[model samples]
Structure formats: C-alpha cells, structure tokens
Target: MKRRKFIKKSLIGGAAITMPFVLPSGRLFASSGNRMADHVVFVAFAGGVRQQESVLQRYLDDSQAYPSAGNIMYNILDGAPPTDKIVYGTTNYVNGDTPIPKMLSQTLQQQGTFFKEVNASVVGHYAGVNTLLTGNYMFTQGLRNKPLTPTIFEYLRRLTGEKATKTWFIGNGIGNSIPLLDYSTHSDYGAQYGANFLAPIVTFGNSGDKHLKNAKVYHPEEELDPMYKMKYFLDNVWYSQGSALPNIGNTEEEKLEIKQFVRDMFQKKDNGSIAFPPISDSGDLQTIGYACEVLKRFKPTLTVIYLSNVDGCHGNFSSYLRSLHRADHGVGHLWDFIQNQVPEMSGNTTMIVAPEHGRNDDPNGIKDANAFYGYDHSDSNSQRIFNMMVGPGIDSNLSIGNENNKVGDIVNIAPTIAEILGFKNDIVNTGLLASNQSFFDLI
Candidate 1:
C-alpha cells in the first residue's frame, strides 16, 4: 500500500519485464480496516447481452411465443420462464424436452437489490470487463494484453492483507484475454497481488484429463526426460496464445494448499461426488459447477466466475437466447448451492452479477440454423447494461434506476466492491481509480 515502493522491474527470458511493488512491505497493507462482508463472488455474466432482450424488453413472450410476458429467469428476477418457448433448456417441453424445474424458490432480485440500467464504459468485451474490474476505462487497451490499471483483486489483497488462496477467478475458458483479467500490469499492483485463475473446462476436462488428471511427482535425477516433457507441455499448452501461467500470488505454504485443493477437486470429479445440481449441457453450467466446488472447498474471499456462451449472439440468435437462459439457470444453481450447501459462506457472502456489455440493437445480417437473425454489439444500445447484487450489507428487494433515469457505471463497480470490503478510500488513495465513485455512493 505504500506509494514510494511502487514501480519495480524484473527480467524474464532476457527481456526486461517490469513488475512493480515487489518489496516485502508492499505485499501487506491496512488489514485493520473494517469489512462489510466476509466474502464476495463476482459473476462477469459476460458475452454481451442486449438490454432489449434482457431487463428492458423482457421479450420471452414475444420472442418465444410463451403464454406470459413476465420474467423467464425465475432465480435471478421476479418472474417465470417462458412456459411455451421451451428452447432455453426447460424440462417442460411439449414434443422435445420436458420442463426443467425451477432452481430456487425465491428470486435473487427478491432477496437483493437490482440496478435496472447501469451504464457500461465500452461496448467491446475485454474493455467492458476491464472497466468493471479496474474502475477505469482503458480506451487504448488492446485485445491481447492485461489491463493497465490495477484490478479490485489486487486492491483487495494489497489493502486488506488477504492471502492469494482467498482469491480466485474461475473462468469459463481462456480466450480474448480473459485469463489476463485475474491480475493487472499496474506499477504498484501486479502478479504479487493477482488472483489465481483456473479454467475448469480446459484444466479438468479433456485436456486436463490428459495432462494433469493423474499427474504424479517425479524424482529430479531419475526422470529428467519426463520432467522436461511435463515442463514443455505446460509451457506450450497452458501458455498458448499469450496466456500466462497460474500466477499464484501466495506464500510457499499457501501455494501448496492450492495444489492440494486442485488435486482433491480432480478426485471428486473422477468419483462423481461434486454434488452439482441437475443441469443441461452448457459450458457456463460446467464452469459454475467448478465455481461451486471452489467455494465449498476454499471459500475464497473474492471469487469471479465468467460466463460467455451468450457470445453465440454474433452468429446465432436462437442459440444466444438459449445461452442467456441457461446462463441464468446456472447462476441460480450457483447461488442456491452457496446458500444451502456452503455453510461457511452462506449468510456472510455477497454476490454481484453483471455482463461485460450489451448486444447491438439491430441484426448483423447473419442467419442461424433456426433462420433467426444474428447480432453484434456496436451501437449506443450496446453500452446499456445492468448490475445485480444480493447478500449481507446490501438492501434487499430494492430496484434502482430505469430507462429514462439511467444510473451507475461500469467504473463504479470496482469501487463499490472495494467499499463493501472496506477499502474504497484506500484504493482511491492509490490514485488508481480516483475518479470512479462507488455504486452505493451514486445511489
């Protein structure tokens, strides 16, 4: 947290890699500060959902020919799913699939607060996520690099003395610099304070099963070839397309604890004891399952899970709707798991859900298998988004803002989370997100 010890440099592969705040004193900060909640789970409900299709229009009836026009997302919003469309993985189907039962008795909005129309900083996927996490709009940020500003994870760890094991970013998949968002390249806060990111599908599915499912330790002198092969595989596949390794920002003991957690997770997966809810086949649902596992095991202080199947909107409108609906279902299951299963984090955790950006108001001229028009986020409508939060310290059943009176910004999110964890001022004092106000303050 000290400003003077910022901006340190290091070398990697004979190239000057500047890693800031490497001093021992820089690793620990104001641990004495008060906290609003014991834990936070941030869902980057990503891949650009259009407001017209989501909070604003509520087009289930119109788009899917349902009997009712109310909310189809029964878990997150106070409404029912499209009873007739039945394409969004509902177990209740007439000729094909039956109606999938509701996951929760109470909706997330009924138990928490809702921001109907939050403003996003940018329309691009990576930039929108960057704004949400960093509390700053990186106008010049490329699609391939990490954010220039420090993320809330770095601020939370550096300002609160939270261990690396207490923070994690469970990604749906590693693409479009999604892995890079776990940390930042800021001078005062970098990998030393980054979150541990894991892509469950890539790490625990087919590739993981091949590479690490039953990985065993090797003796250095006896198995040099095997060791080199393992190292080569890790370097080539794990870091492919500019992806960084699992930059575990932890002490030696904490690192070992994380490794053990991963091993145990693999065992549970193999033994079919994960206790996941009955869910349809979707990447987002799979990611949420792993996220629940992480919560059950580690109960990390800050965990962010990203869902991106909705990006199918770019080429398939029908699939986009299905993905959005399934994403909501997955989210509902995750929240339910936290409340009913994770006893250690049940009542004390806060959950924040928001998309990276909104989709285009018009079609992109692409037709899908269903003959539905495809869309890409581009116009002003793409900038309109929303944020929902439920947990301790947040007002329940409260709705803020509307179409005519739009409030909140993507930048406000990071500061709001910082304030929830009692470090808004500390993060602002660092001059990283000085201009952004906490969403609580805005309301």
Candidate 2:
C-alpha cells in the first residue's frame, strides 16, 4: 500500500481498536416534521458581554463616562461606527484606531429579527453556557462537571435521528470544560447522541504539527498485531471494572472523512487558503476561520461556535473592546462565507447569535492602559442580553423587545433551534427545559 493510504488505514484501524465501545440505543421513533431551514448555526457570543456596551451601543459613554457614544459592532447591529477615541482594529492603519471595514452590505439586524433585550439568569461562564445549550438554568452545574441534562446536540440527534457528523460543537479552546459540552450525562441521551467536538486551534496548531503532522505506516502483521491485542486486553480490563469508554459513535466512514478533513485543513493553512477573515489576529478570529472550513466541508445540520475573547474585560477594557469588535467582524465573515462560498448551506441556514450572559453594570476598579475601568459579571445588569436570527422564513428588519421590555430568555435558544430544524415538539415533550417556548412562540 502507498505510504499515505497505509497511514490513513492504520489511523482508522488504530482508532477502532483503542476506542471500542457500544452506541446508545436512541429513541425508537423519529419525528416526522418539516424543517424551517436545512441547517442551524448557533454562535455563543459568550464571555460576559455587557448590555450597556453591546445592545445599547453606548461605546464609551456609559462605561467610562465619556460623552462619545456610537456603535462598535456595525456588522451585526445597524448603527454607524464609533467616530472618536477608536482603538478596536488592526494597528497597520493607525495604532488600532481604524475599525475593520464591514463585511456585510446590510447588518444582520436589518436582514433578520432582532431581540434587542433578552434575559440570562446565570452569570458565571460554565453555568451560563450550560443554560444556553441545555435550556435550563442549572444552578447546580459545577465548573468541572458535564451538563446534568441532555444538551441540544443530544436532543437533535436522538429525537430526529441525525448522525454525529451532522452536528458539531466547535469551541475556541479546550478550556473551562468546553469539550464536555458536546454531550451530557443524561441517561436517555448521552455519548451516542453527542456532537463531534473540536478545539481547532489546539488540534491544528503547534501541538498538532508536532504530534499528528506525520505518521509512520505500520505494517499490518509486523506492527499492528501486537497493538490490536494490547488494545483488546486493555478494553476488557476496563470493562470488567464496570467502566466503558465514551465515544461519539462516528461511523468508520465519518471518522475517515474527519481525519481527511483535518489533513486538508493543515494543507490549507500552509498554502494560506484557509477562509479566515481578512484580519485574523485574535484566537476568536482563527476559530471562526476553522468554523467556516467545517461549514463548507460538512454542511452540518447543526453547528455551534463558542467565542470568549471579550472576557478580557475583567482587567483590560481596551482589549475587551477590540475583541468584541473583532468578534463582530468574524461573525460577518462567517455569514458572508456561508452565503457566497458554501452553496450547500447558502440561503438554507438559520444563524442565531446570543451571549451566554452579560457583565456587571458597575466596574471592578481595574483600569487598562487606556485608563478604562474593567467590569465583571455579578449584578442584575448581567442578566441582560440580545438574540438575533436571520434566514428563510424569518421576518426581515423586525425588532422585538427593548431595554425596558425583554421578550426572550437565554433558555429559549435551544428550542428555537429545535423549532428551526423541525424537532421542537420532541425536545419540548421531554419536559427538561426551563422554558418550553421557542423564540417563534414569542413572535
């Protein structure tokens, strides 16, 4: 066998042996329903966004007591860019003073329904994201523990019979228990129904380059026989101890495809062909680039991207502002890529963006180099957030709720996604969510 082909086969065979496990028996019946769209992309605009800085577009007016006020997130919100005291773009222009050019002709708020104000009950990162994915304010959820309830991935896969590859949880990094969110520990829906998880930066960065960029082709008889026997022996020993390995239940074909996709991504990176935003400086931007690649290659029925670079507000408010600005740019790029590059998902995908939680109304007294005060999340203002959706069957330029009248909750996102994908009834019937109402119901 050719060396490349042998390496591929060897990796597949080795994975099969080392990760041997049983697939969960999903629900006996599948839902028979019509989908509003063929795909759903959920962006967890997380890391404690503040309502004053974000939806209010207060810029420096509310946060720093500076009279200057304008929108810094022009791609998602329909507002003019901030005019003065700019520090949220590439330094190549003028000391990071010039904002990145908007990628979308029309803002997402103009193209979709925008919930100006939404409620998030949880303030911490882990609980906040857990609530977003599971649609429950799991106050008991620990920072180190997997979700206590079935995540949306499990709900979609088990109730609708979607394959593992058709769903994904692409996290920015493998920190703060992000990889665990792909699945939950729920009895009815667990590993078998989990989405494939990838922290692409870690997977494709220096660590991957060092460990996975090359593989020696091991001869089947001379090298593989002993490895297979050792794997089986270890599996038996582990199983005998009443423990079993967790698997996402990717079929051999799906595994091979994923492996090949990883290889292709590395090659693309080398050739400067990865579909990154024009300015890919931050970790969030790089993650978004990989996310675009995933969308083009898999065209998944459901894909969740988590970005948290804006969490820098804890100490460096200027950097936080820059991260928030770049996040908006990345989102604009992602939507533009789907519409113009990924034909399979173009006009057939519903994209939803919501922060897991909001930051405090008051600052923590820590100032940045720009003499800006840092903020944390722990007050009522932290409950404030916004949710936006754009796609077929959704109303255009419709603005709902406001600063005084909140129309939706963070928990509504999972069912909203389920509704878009035609599985809302199944998900709601489980009686697991805090709010059974989808965002459509609010309309």
Candidate 3:
C-alpha cells in the first residue's frame, strides 16, 4: 500500500482522501487509512423514523407535551433514569445527566450528535431508503428498485480497488441497485444484486458463504473441499446412484428433482434454506443476525447492517418505539465490539446511524400518511427525518442543534465520510457533499 499517496490533499492536486495503496488489479488509490477502525461499520435504524419519540426527542424539549415524560428507551430503563434517555438516546430533547442514555445500556454511552432539521422528498417506502442510503433524493421511479445514485460503499471500493466481496448490504427490500450501490462507475461490488451487473468473482452474496450449509451438504467425509468437492462428487456419482434414493424415484425427472435440491445449497440457513427451522422463519431477525455474524469473520472495510422491521412498526406507534430502540441497541452492540471488545478497532472505526426517512405524523390509523384522509410527510417542517454519528475521535457531549427546529440536510453525510476517508473524488463533493456540507470538522 502506498501510504504516502493517501496523505493530506496539500500534496496531491490539493486534495487528501486517505492512503494511496495499489489494488489487486494494480491501480493506485486512497483509503480512509488502516487505523483500528479501517473497518467501517454502518448500523442503520431501518424504518421511517419518528422524531417526536426517539432521536429527535421533540416531545422532551417541549414542556407542553409531557412536562416530565421520557422517550421509549429511557422509559424502559431499570429506574427509568433521566440521563440514560438523553445521553444514550440523544436525550437532549428530554432531560440531562442520565448517563448519556445508552440505548443498549450495556454497551457504550454518549449522545453522539443529532441532525434535527432534516427532511426527505417522499414518505413512500423506496424513496425514503433511497435518499437516506444514497445521500441524495432519487426522484420517484414507481417502486421498480431504481437507486437514486451510487453510494458510499461504491466510492470506497473505487478509490481503493476493493471488491463487493469485501462489502455487505444486509437487507431484503432496500431500493439501492447497481447505480446506487456502485455509483454508476464500476458495476461490481454489491452483495445481493452484484451478479446482475458485475461478475460473481468480485461481487458475491451470503448464499455462497453459509457454513452450516457447507457442513450439511458436504458431510464429514465430503467436507474437505466444500464447493469444489461438491462439484466433483456430483459430476462423478449423481447419475449412477438413483435406487438408493428410490423414494425420490429412479428416472431422469427424479434426477433433475434431486439436483434441484442443491439449488440454494448452503445459503446460510436462511428462511429460503432447507436447513432453516420453523423458529428461524422470521426473515428480518435472521437477516440481522446473519449479517452481524458475517461481519465478525470478514470485517470488511465497508459494511451496511440493514434493519427493515421499523417501517412496519410505524403503523403501530408504541410498537414502533420499541422497534427503534431495539435497532439502536443493535448498533450499540456493533460499536461495543469494535471499540472495546476488539481493542485494535477502538478509535480507528467510524459509524453512522440513521433511518431511511421520516414517517407521516399520523394520529389516525392508516398506512399512507399521504392517503386521502391521512397526512404522511407534510411539505412543511414536521415531515423531515434526522441522522447521527459516533465513534473514534468523534466529539462527545456535543449536539448539532442543542435546540429545536435545527435543520441538518441529507447531503452532509457522504462528503463527510468521503472527507474523513480522504476521497477528493468530484461526485461526492458535487452531489451529496456540496448540498449537505460535510460534518467532518464538527466531529
């Protein structure tokens, strides 16, 4: 790695983006640098957010709503302590000295920072996630899985020559595609939708990395070489042995049926996998847990942990609060593992936690806030969503808008990360960076 090339921008064309290292394909690029947090763990809250309750804490600041009330997380804490809510839950809108209101309570503590005055273009499912993840509003494409634009992950890979194999997007219904995931430059490098645009060698998925599946199919004697051995074994013995599998019927049709059994062979005991038990059928939990486990092993330079259950909980407000807290707890756990559990990663890593978008302020029971009788996201102030970040050299005890109605735009995120990672690339600066204004200096 050419650590020198990644030095501060003063040396190269007046730009500084990280370390300049040569990629496997022999291209020199800059990376955020190999610090303890060389691995970026982005834990997403994954839902249409509610500012009044959790991160926004509007209900707290306004004494009129509930003079001494606490948000969902603080309310659940053992003593229902005050600091726990403000500190851990970014409880500024509520109270003070509650031990930074740690969401996991067992993990790290600190309010991190909040971007309160933020809004989105749409309240619909895909649009919310698209803008949040891509850092720019993607004009509605009518739910056809169109990404707003390329994402941070794509930029990271290009600047450093890292493959999608090193990145993981853990969610089912997210709207980011090649253009969004890869930033319209290099097509390969996303997990789920990789093969569609790039070759499998560079872009891959969990389906190809399930340990239990490898164990089941290639049992004790056949486990020596999982993929390759399975291929060899099937080639030599599949056609010859049928009666032994008689229940499956001995015919070309049966043979095809038997082979189809391996269709998703060892795809990580997923809901779609044969090895999955009924209890593990819930796709959301399985995905969250599986992706976290994968991160333990690969620890990719860039990773995204997608928790999409929050959107459903939005329809039911109380349940939605718990959902948000649980997701926050999940992020706290990931952060803990990096900062303390894994000492080397302590200050080197950086994390950003935010929701796909804001939910409609619906007092009435309805799905679409914009429906005839309902109001989802108002063109007015209440409809915008907010985001925050914490970890490694980040300013603790700081609040972007310690007060109410503070506006933090979406474009601020990508360039901030790009700036931290030291990417002088033009798009992030021109697109998301320029609009939102990077928060690099603040942290």
Q: Report, for every candidate in turn, its global Cα lDDT versus the true structure.
A: 0.79, 0.91, 0.47
Question: What TM value does model 2 have?
Answer: 0.90
Report the lDDT of model 1 for residue 56: 59
| Model 1 Cα lDDT, one tens digit per residue, 96-197 | 234446787888888988998988869998888888788898898888898898888888888877888888888989997899998888877788888988
Q: Model 1: C-alpha RMSD to truth?
A: 8.9
* Superior candidate under TM-score, 1 versus 3: 1
Q: lDDT score, residue 147, model 1?
A: 86
> Each model's RMSD to truth, in Å?
8.9, 10.4, 12.5
C-alpha-based local distance difference test score of model 1: 0.79
Model 2: per-residue lDDT, tens digit, 1-443?
69999999999999877863433435655565689999999999989899887889999999999987888899999877788888777786556787899999999999999999999999988899889999999988878899999999999988887898999999999997888899999987889899999999999899998887675455556776788789889888888887777888898579768888988888898999999999999999999999999999999999999999999999999999999999999999999999999999999999999999999999999999889999999999999999999999999999999998999999999999999999888888899999899999998
Please report the candidate that would top lDDT against the real structure.
2
lDDT of 2 at 285: 94
Candidate 3 per-residue C-alpha lDDT over 396-435 given as tens digits, one digit per residue, 9 for 90 to 100: 5455553355466665666656655556354344444335
Question: What is the lDDT, from 0 to 100, of the residue 153 in candidate 2?
Answer: 94
TM-score of each: 0.84, 0.90, 0.61
Pick by TM-score: which candidate is best? 2
Candidates, ranked, TM-score: 2, 1, 3
TM-score of 3: 0.61
